[model samples]
Target: MQTLSELGLAVAQRRRALGMTQIDVAKRAGVASDTLSRFELGKATDFGARKLLAVLAVLGMEMQYSLEGHAGSLESLAREHGLRR
Candidate 1:
């Protein structure tokens, strides 16, 4: 995602898809329930990497990275470069 709010929303979606509660995820991730609530609600401004990674781990998820202009998938890149029809 392009921003922290987007990331938080994604986490919330995943949690819901997995039928997980905020308290359960927070306990498993070693964070406060209010913290997770704020995060999922896009109200957290300083949720750190450790807590984020912990939550992702609890949800069987991980973060990915790409340089600014290198975020496209292979299919999109091929299309943009005229290598695909």
Candidate 2:
């Protein structure tokens, strides 16, 4: 499982690889550049999921879910924790 910092790094690397600046991504994602900077820095305080998703969409990425090792299905985990998927 990648930590928030790792994920942030990956996003930053991908953006750089595509020759896109932070400002470009911010404009494309409809977010402020400072917010995007915080995300790239792995601040992880209160990043809105929808905002992150929008940013990722601009970077040609989408969120997906999967089990962690042999942790069983996500449905089972959600049921155990009273979470809805």
Candidate 3:
């Protein structure tokens, strides 16, 4: 499992790669600039899923779970077992 600090670093790297400022992401995600700043600084302890998703969306990314070195689609596997919609 990735630590929150690692995830925050990933988010910051992605945003920087896209030349996006914290205020830009805040505007796009409808969050406060300070909130996004805290997220990027790894100071946020309890990030809400929807807010995190919004932030990822602004950075042109989506959250997913996967096993290490797996090539198969998790969604497909889940559907095969009727595990998720």
Best by TM-score: 1
Output the TM-score of candidate 3: 0.73
Candidate 1 lDDT, 1-85, residue by residue in tens: 8788889999999999999999999999999999999998899989999999999999999998889769788998888888974
Score each candidate by Cα lDDT.
0.94, 0.86, 0.85
Instruction: Candidate 2: count the clashes.
Output: 0
Per-residue alpha-carbon lDDT of model 2 for 1-62, expressed as tens digits?
37777778888998999999999999999999988898899986767888889889999987
Off by over 4 Å in 3: 67-85
Query: How does model 1 score by TM-score?
Result: 0.87
Please report the candidate that would top lDDT against the real structure. Answer: 1
**TM-scores, all models, native as reference:** 0.87, 0.74, 0.73
- Model 1, position 12, has a per-residue lDDT of 97
RMSD of each: 1.8, 7.6, 7.5
TM-score ranking from best candidate downward: 1, 2, 3
Sliding window of 10 residues with minimal summed lDDT for model 1:
64-73
Residue pairs clashing, model 3: none
Pairs in steric clash, model 2: none
Weakest 10 consecutive residues of candidate 2 by summed lDDT: 63-72
The residue-level lDDT of candidate 3 at 21 comes to: 92
Please say which candidate is ahead in TM-score: 1 or 2.
Answer: 1
Ranked by lDDT from best down, the candidates are 1, 2, 3
